[model samples]
Target: MDYIDSICNASASILDMTPAVRKPEEGKVVLDYILDNCAKWPNKIFLTQPMGGDEVLNVTFSEFLSESKKMAAYIESLNLPAPSQIAIMSKNCVWWLMADLAIMMSGHCAVPIYPTLTAETVKYTLEHSESKLLFVGKLDTHPWNEMKKGIPAGMSCVSFPICPSDVSYDKWADLIGDNEEIKEIKKRTPEEMATIIYTSGSTGVPKGVMLSFKNLTDTTFGLINTTHATENDRYLSYLPISHGMERWVGECLPFITGLHVFYAESLTTFVQDLNRCQPTLFLSVPRLWTKFQLGVFKKMPPEKLQKLLKIPFISYLVKKKLLKALGLNHVRYAGSGSAPLPPDLLAWYRSLGLELLEGYGMTENFNYSHMSKPGGGRVGYVGEPSEGVEQRIAADGEIQVKSPGMMMGYFKNEEATKETMTEDGWLRTGDKGELDDAGRLKITGRTKEIFKTSKGKYVAPAPIENQYISNIRIELACVGGRGHQAANAILMLSEDAKKEAAESGGKDAIEKELEELIKTVNSGLDDHEKLQFVAVVNDVWEPENGFLTPTNKIKRARIEEEYNPLMEEWYNSKKKVIWHKW
Candidate 1:
């Protein structure tokens, strides 16, 4: 029997489940699209970057192109070698995109570093990639202070106008003003390298994935086709541009469609920025989606909101008011990715009239993979294989994919690249999944993340962890107990849930609710997979604390290392729920 047949409905043929790898159509590259947009809509607003309250600077397409060309000329004047690597370290902003365009125009590849990385990791990436120059832009004080130490002294540096005032560098405005705009655009072949994206892994050193111009163009066209993207669409760019999804959807897609892009000022002003943009398409990770829901619950209690939603006329108005306040009333398409969203949460958003969909992808493929169809999505599955994407499950149950936008290789790491790719050219996804009757893909867990208990039965933690977080009281969870009789879950409470615990009788109510939740969750699991107890940890796991990645995915290895030693003690407590301190 075939792998697809093993999991999918008997009537669904294997050929229907796996499509042939599609070749990219010969066409103009992303740079060509930008040039075309400039010629077509020279005076149209291209980027809206916020400053302080009620103040935003909007740049027209002509202005953007002219400034980028000037920056390119300035870069050329430095006499750097062709195909040099230029690094940009900043939060999402307009100048960040401009620096990227300048790098492209200057006939170089860009290396974007996450703004939240530690000094040591930052130094490692820059040194490993051998970046020739660095562009520093919009960042907070503490992060800049920490990240600056990683920059190699005497390295050529340029500063965007909105950068921290503590350090002096050649200013973007002054440099572009001093230089002449290059009259000719740099011509690039489709096969030429475009960028080196370093994966911010949950464990170990980050690997730089090399992608070509054709790879990006192929992925962009696939995205445009599936999403029905148009020039009238609006996008709010808040995620790190260094990430693959943001780079593809937020940065690359806009060039092709001339869509207006808005930059979020800061976390403090995200809601205000969202209101200003009122984006048509929105994408976020599960953590943020949960936070958004919790934000709503903070205003009106969930019980009251549910009761109000049951009324006919009042339900319509309540939904409208809530969605409008969240700045999602205009969102025609919404998506969740990077991690699994609890099904109830997904249902919650859909119930409110937002078309929230789930997607699946990784950095290696430029995130051009599966996405739920507008109205064809299942609760727990990411939609079927995208056009030109081929997927197959190996005998070991790992999902391997071949896509048009697959990376060329890892930068300066042939061994790792070779290990990741199969001889037939498919990229190993490292994820275990199953195909359903409707061809949706349900990711079970990471193959490497599965742990065997003392009874010798392997346990996949993802589904169980999902069960824990589905109860709104828990914000994040990790399930483990590799050598124990049964697994255990460590939980972090949501801010509001914690606040509730501080009030009279609130802690007892939460405790009772959690005890019931664990019982209900355990009833559905295999005996060996059932959790012995759940510990409510006193501290929250965050990126700064080294417990989570910058993207909010837990660093499992770190979590296990910190907690596995005390597993016996936790098990000895003999309580269904335990309050733990580390």
Candidate 2:
């Protein structure tokens, strides 16, 4: 059977049966639910952050509302262009949410850019939105300055610190000033555009997905049909707010559920924050989940871990201990999306008493589509559709979605917008998938990245690439064989893994060990699926260097471009067996 057939079978065995779907009541907007619920659950924790030397900051629903109101007032006072756009260029932070709500309250649209966005993309976003103000975060100022040339003159720029030279610049503090007489703007129409989230254009210029308040609210509440959230549930907000998954899960869901949200201080402190928060709920992209699984593999050999997992009594004890150690003992609902998840990683986490519900959605729909049941998770598939959304397999197996969360349209690009929507309005997901008799969705490779080798056999890069990176030492993997004789992969090794190998043994010994790793990864694949060459570089793929996303996912296109010059050496030379040849 082909890989898609294999995935379909594998998914059915795990994801086919889940909780009965529950449809949410129609006619609710996210902003309405947030304001109403906040008034009701005033003391419920809304937003949390740590400011003082690694200490975590916690804010209640009342405080979040108050702060949001203050920020709204200041935004209103700005008196810029009417119905203007507010752009937030920052990572995941409490201030990002504050800025989002402030924009909404001021009757404006929000454009949240990815923190790892190229200066060109950033400038494009600002210009595309025709933003009246930029609420710059306390981030590396270099990118802002780099893109300053792209900033439209008279398109006012104000850093969050809102410095002295920043004429009439607004600080977060300005939101809560003594001026309490701010006029109330009417509640947003359900159809009003609330946010414009730019898709991470790992391919090209990022497209702004214009979402209405209704889109978010409907999807979020619809997801709640499968979730059992309470005012007491604790949520960790570590994922980038710019992404629709995080925005809906970390922000929109919290508003309706009244869950406590603790924002991580920074990327370096995320794990520490997770431990400190001990959140009952958490959401992560498959890439990060893969990283964590790799971290675990680094400490314990995969073979040994697999062996230990098989011993019945020992497996129970090991999982219990690991869950308690990771503070995931109380995780009621853990989830992953944005990319396909490796089944091995998914099963390993499930064994640890964590039910990570792998789900699916994209920017256009505000990430409200399908999710696995808490206990009934399907590792390789993003399960059945949620309440109120219809799922259908298109002619070519692309998952077609029609949800209330579907975007208003693509900002500044009407042609692309029309192309994205179906004649009858189903949003084309661009992902290939299959559904079982039970309606669970199993995703195959992306339609875009399926490449052909010299023999004309197709290679679905992600699956093969995921297997290679399972070695723990390989941090980034990009697979391709298009325009080549055979399929090959370029892998960037973990920095620490390289140093560890060198310290433990010599360069030659490490080289041999890496070859063994490649052989092991290759042994599991079919002839066409096996990699012909693997480029294992010792250097790190950093976001600062444009090789990674804000979420630390590899930039496949960029990696391919940078390594195109080395392809001949990697393939033609016998030294290509191990990547150190270059």
The TM-score leader among the candidates is: 1
lDDT of candidate 1?
Answer: 0.84
Worst 10 residues of 1 by lDDT: 1-10
Give each model's whole-structure lDDT.
Answer: 0.84, 0.70
lDDT of 2 at 152: 60
- Candidate 1 per-residue lDDT, tens place, 64-169, comes to 9888989988988887899999999988888887888888888999999988788988899899999999999988888788889999989899999899988698
Question: Candidate 2 clashing pairs?
Answer: 49-57, 50-57, 70-175
What TM-score does candidate 2 reach?
0.88
lDDT of 2 at 61: 72
Candidate 2: which stretches are off by over 4 Å? 1-27, 54-56, 140-154, 158-169, 294-317, 504-526, 580-582
Candidate 1 vs. true structure, TM-score: 0.94
Candidate 1: pairs in clash = none
